[model samples]
Target: MEWDLKVIDELPDYMKMAFLILYNFTNEMVFNDEMKRGDVPTSIQCYMHDTGISEDEAREHIKHLISESWKEMNNENGDHNSSFSKEFVHVCKNLGRASQFIYQYGDGHASQNTLSKDRIFKIIINPFPYKL
Candidate 1:
């Protein structure tokens, strides 16, 4: 699609952090995008630098980000643009739901316990055993 990532640079560091949460989730679902350049520590430092917030404030901001991201991903609750297909909307919601679990434990992904390849396979490839 020749997408331009430069657009993401326009966002404030905290927002960029929030967007990365969704982006990382979506990228896991739909791979082959541009590789991430910066490390998590660098991103977090930028966020704190731009916001001038302490760790407690950062924690609250993270909570708010997670909530807002979930609402934004939801079709009925979010920006329900009619041009998007039902399946596409479902994928968006799925991304949010999956990330909600992943972020439940503080930065749980780095452990590689929750965000494992096997789990991705389960989410993408495994079909529910339903019968008519």
Candidate 2:
């Protein structure tokens, strides 16, 4: 039961989270054990992309990016559109997360911000393992 996009914005933050969890409740709760496979929290990944300097701090503000795109991941495919597969939400989330990561440091989208560019390059390009 999806509501209008604008209506979600009007909802309190907790309700916003409820909407998401309820939307994909069946997505298995994943944890790292022996199998080494799990559901990546792309929402949090996207949040980190927006503002995480290290892996320690992570976060989700995806709606505005694709204009109420949470609909695309409703565990069902559509005409000329594909479902995000509750657990994987796939490349659409990837693109949105990329956007979050790129712009997390304040308008770093164009790569004009030297500090942001360097941060991006260091974390993504010249990367080494993060310890904490």
Candidate 3:
């Protein structure tokens, strides 16, 4: 789905800043993953370019958004509605765990020079030489 910029523009400045931070952070993650360069400076530059905000402002807002997201995720863990099955909840937890492992040291999943590459190789390329 595409984002409606019109709706986003209607938000208050603080809310707009938060949304911009989140959007730029997501873009940074994707770009870094694809480029195999966990370059925070590039991401910050992108945020500044897109939001017309100072680097300090972008950094502060991005950090705030990240902190808020973690708090929300922590609160939601194991507290889903009845519509979500146990298996689905388990999968969600596993996804979060995998994301944490992969990004624990920058864009490790994308950069071959990082420890993530070795971990990924062990997990996907050189699995245990035994039948499950």
TM-score, one value per model? 0.48, 0.29, 0.51
Every model: Cα RMSD to truth: 8.1, 16.6, 7.5
Candidate 3 structure quality by residue, lDDT tens digits, 1-132: 134557777753334444554454454455545445544445556678899998678767666766665555445545344465666655654554455565555445444556766666676789677777
The 10 consecutive residues of candidate 1 with the worst lDDT sum are: 26-35
Report the C-alpha lDDT of model 1 over 80-129, residue by residue, as the tens digit.
Answer: 45565666555655655676464443233333445454555555577455
**CA lDDT for candidate 3:** 0.56
How much does candidate 2 score in TM-score?
0.29
Error of 1 at 45 (Å): 2.6
**Who is ahead in TM-score, 1 or 2?**
1
- Model 2 clashing-pair count: 3
For residue 62, model 2's alpha carbon misses the true position, in angstroms, by 12
Task: For model 2, name the residue pairs that clash.
Answer: 47-59, 49-101, 50-104
Give the residue spans of candidate 1 off by over 4 A.
1-43, 75-81, 102-109, 112-132
Model 2 segments more than 4 A misplaced: 1-67, 70-89, 106-115, 129-132
> For model 1, what is the alpha-carbon lDDT of residue 84?
55
For all candidates in order, the CA lDDT equals 0.48, 0.41, 0.56
